[model samples]
Target chain A: MDLFEHQGKELFARYGLPVPSGEVALSPEEAVAAASRLGLPVVVKAQVHTGGRGKAGGVKLAADLDAVRGHASDILGLDISGHIVRRLWIEQASDIAEEYYASFTLDRSARKHLGMLSAEGGVEIETVAAENPDAISKVLVDPAEGLTEEAARAWVEGANLNPAATDQAVEILRKLYVAYTEGDADLVEINPLILTPEGRVHVLDAKVTLDANAVFRHEDYAQYDETQPRDEREEAAHAKGLQYVGLAGSVGVIANGAGLAMSTVDVVNQVGGKPANFLDIGGGANAQVMANALEVINNDPDVRAIFINIFGGITRGEEVANGIIGALEAVDIEAPIVLRLDGTNAAEGREILAPHLNEKLVMEPTMLDAARRAVAMAAA
Target chain B: MSIFVNKDTKVVYQGLTGSQGRYYGMLNRDYGTNVVAGTNPRKAGTDVEGVPVFANCTEAVAATGANASCIFIPAPGVFAAVMDAAEAGIEFVACITEGVPAHDEARFFNMLKRDHPGVRLLGPNCPGIITPGECNIGITAGHIAKPGGPVGIVSRSGTLTYQALYELQQKDIGVTTCVGIGGDPVPGTSFIDCLEAFEADPDTKAVMMIGEIGGSAEEEAAAFIKDNMSKPVSSYIAGVTAPPGKKMGHAGAIVSGGKGTAAAKMDALRDAGVRVGLNPTEAGELMAEIVAEL
Candidate 1:
């Protein structure tokens, strides 16, 4: 899950990384109060999940209290990348003698945690990679050994940073690795890891994405999840532990896998019907799960037809048939159901559902046919 | 005739006492996998479903001569389970456990490369490999796979893999093997690995590779196909319109930094003379056409 800027900085501070002391404020008055407490010359950063915030005018430096108030009010409701700013992080501004970049992320091809350090920062890393690739020093960290001081020192030297910043960068790099691995973060990026004239290094900006799977270990991560901008249907689906994406359409989709679920939605659209939502039951099609999915879709007033697409793998087709039968008994579903069941005893499954076959609970032999049937039903 | 697994590959189950392990282990045995014994150190000597239970892979191997083992343990113990399997000299390991920490997967993957050179790992979050009418490891339903020797399949999603196989079955085309390399950000194997195996396999004629929107595995496989493959290859990429940031079910299914998009992957494969399908059904039809022409 993506963390807001204030949350990322808070997480960084927990790891003992040096972040400019910041206060999160929801209003211009709070921003001015924070500035007064931090003692003038603050930077107001809009707290949103997307990047290019500076270019989008979501970030500004305030030389005084008046500037902080003005910048905070201006950035409060600014929209950046479809995310409207609801909060601002007012931080004490720091002097920058030099800026550098450091990040840790999983490198899928290498099958290792990747660490990148660059002497040049405060710009897009992609540009650095494209224009002057050598400026960025890439390190593939063995998870067993991790980014040790020796390796980090070598990486820092490879980036060709100033000698004054070498030891400190290495120290900070080691801590960042701990923050990355121990924190269960998928990505941790510090842009403009600044070196001050006073010979101190501080984190100017932080971008953190925690592994959603690791949420089981971190309970406090729920607060971060609460910040996600999901519609009511998506929120309901999430609460029920189903993978769902809300869409503006009439056909409610339920499928077994992520890919197949997506394909089901696409086929629904291709066959001249809009998908109401994308719901994946993820290998299990038990009565309880089917009921939950049906109940969630039934709540959507836009849904005129429901497409139940099940491709049995480990799950037997008979079980899916039984689940659908039981779910129909359990939930008061409003829309007509069109199911395309196949694989793993699908004939037996079809035989079991044969008794309940009607205009309301219909079965199509193919995904294309099922989609078409659902679309036609919705249209009718 | 299959790529990695067949009737001859003896299997050991890790965490077989657990619900998922016991269920799939029995199903695999029922499907004609050479099911030997299972490992659960605490439940050693306990037999579930007539399959003997051993203290560890070491004991299981010494008794049953098992080479390939499938793990069904929870995520936390997966790292240790994989290491134990490798230490016991199991050459082929397929982990069905999902939610393994990326760090743990990296460590185990590195250890397998640096130390257990003989080990062939398939997945940490996969459906495993299947050879039709022979043996099935992982969670794939055996009835869906028809026994034949025309196409070899590789996919990152289990249900989608089954869907592609069913589509082939509907076309009266059966696969020599179907390998699910898994959908984790860092999988134990890659599309290129299975592609190379399929390219070398004598029974396999054409290949169907299914990938999602995450990672450059499809792009890398396209390069491999261009340079080395002699057989026809059909490609299907999922999540063509998936949002750039949101993960589409799989950990590896995220579109990051403008890369790993379905369009980009399809473009690369098309450039490499591969037949690209926008959806699974279309991809299945394309494979049928390729096989018919051959």
Candidate 2:
């Protein structure tokens, strides 16, 4: 899960990384109060799970309390690439002598933790990579050994960071590595890591993405989960432990696996029908799971037709068919469901559904046929 | 012969007393795999059906001469289970447990690389490998696979792997083996691993690869196919319609920072002289055509 800048900074603080003292504000009044507590010249940053906040006018430098209130009120409702700001991080502004960038993320190809350090900061790292790839010092750390202090010191020097800030930067880099690994973070980035006039390296901005699968180990991550962006249908699906993504279309897609669900969505669009949502019931197609998935998709008024595609792997076709039949009996579905069942015992599954075959409940032999039928029904 | 396993491969279950373990382990044994032993510390000296249970993989391996291990342990216990199997000197380990922490996977993956270089770990969240009518390891349905040769399949998704298998079966085409690399950030195996194995296997003629949005594994596999293999490769990448930043069920199936897109993967495969299909069904048909030419 991607953490907002404020949340990332809070996590960085937990690791003893030096960050400008900040307070989270949910309203304009709260922003003023936070600014007053932090003294004048505070940075009011919009707390949204997206980037380019400064360019989008969601971040403002307030020299006074009135400015803080004005900036907070303006940014609270500002949309940065469709993510609306609902919170603000009012932090004491730091004087920057120089700016540098540092981050640790998984290099998927190398199967190692990758660390990137650069003198070029306060801008998109991608631009630096595109323009002057040599500016960034890349290091692949072995997960078994972790990022050692000696290696981190070399990485800091390789990036050509300010000599005066080298020691502090190295220390922060080690801490950031701790936050990345011990904290179960997929990415821990410090963009525009500032060196103050007094020669102290401080984290000016933090971008951390925690691994959602590891949330079971961290109890505090529940707060981050609460801030996730979800629509009504998505929220309901999440409640039911079903993986669902709301899309803008008329055909509701329910598939067994992630890849199949995505392929189902693509096939629906390939046949000239947009998918209303992408829902994967996962490995199990038991009665409760099927019913929950149907009810969630059935709640979407835009859904003109529902396509239930099951290619049984560990889940047998007979169980899938029974689950669908049981779900149909439990939930009053409005949209027509075009079903396609394949894999183990699929013939037995089809036989089980023979009596239930009707206009509102149709079964197709192949995925392509089922997709076509669903697309045509949606169009009609 | 298949890449990972064949009729001679002896298998052991790491969590044999558990429900999922007993279910799939027996199913695989019933399909003619030599499921010789199972490991459950508490249930040691007991038996599941006719299979003997041991205290750990070491005893299981020593007693039954089991070379491969199919893990059905839960997420938290998966790391230790893999380590135990590797330490026990198992040749191949296929872990079917999902939701394992990435750090644990990365740690053990590198540990195995550093220590037990001979052991081939398939997945910590995969459906495992199946050499049709020979050996079934994880949770893949044995009936969907046909028992001959010419086409070898590898995929990142479980059910889609089954779809590819069924599609080939419909065309009266059989597979030498099907490998699910698992849809996680750190998979034990890669598409290139299976592709290289298939390229080396005489029984396998053509290859079918299924990929989705995530990482550069597919792109790298495409590169490998271009330079190393003489076999025809048919490929399909899912999640063309998947919006950026949305995790599509799988933990690793997401498009982030304008990277790992289906379009990029397809283009790379197409540039490598591989037939890239628009969808799974079409991909299967492309593989069938390749098999027919063979």
How well does chain A score by TM in each candidate?
Answer: 0.91, 0.96
TM-score of 2: 0.97
User: Can you give the DockQ of every candidate in the order shown?
Assistant: 0.59, 0.79
- What lDDT score is found at residue A276 in candidate 1? 87
- Tell me the tens digit of each residue's lDDT in model 2 across A1-380: 88989899999999999999989999999999999998989999998888899999988999988899889989988888999899999999999989898999988899999999999999999999999999999889999899999999888889998789889988889999999999998889999899999888999999998887787789999999888888899999998989999999999999998889999998998989999999999875676787788999999999999999998776677887787788788888999999999876688889999998899999998899999999999989
For residues B159-210, write the lDDT of model 1, one tens digit per residue: 7898888888888898999999888877888899999999999999999998
Q: Candidate 1: misplaced stretches above 4 Å? A: A28-37, A62-71, A345-348, B241-244
Candidate 2 structure quality by residue, lDDT tens digits, B1-294: 889899999999999899889988888888888999999899999999989999999999899899999999888888899999999999999999888888888999999999999999998778899999889998888888898888999999988898888888888899999999999889999999999999999999899999998788999999999999999999899998788877788888888888899989899999999998888889988988898788
* Pairs in clash, predicted candidate 2: none
Q: After superposition, how far is residue A237 of candidate 2 from its true place, in Å?
A: 1.4
Q: What C-alpha lDDT, on a 0 to 100 scale, does residue B27 get in candidate 1?
A: 87
Q: What are the models' TM-scores?
A: 0.94, 0.97
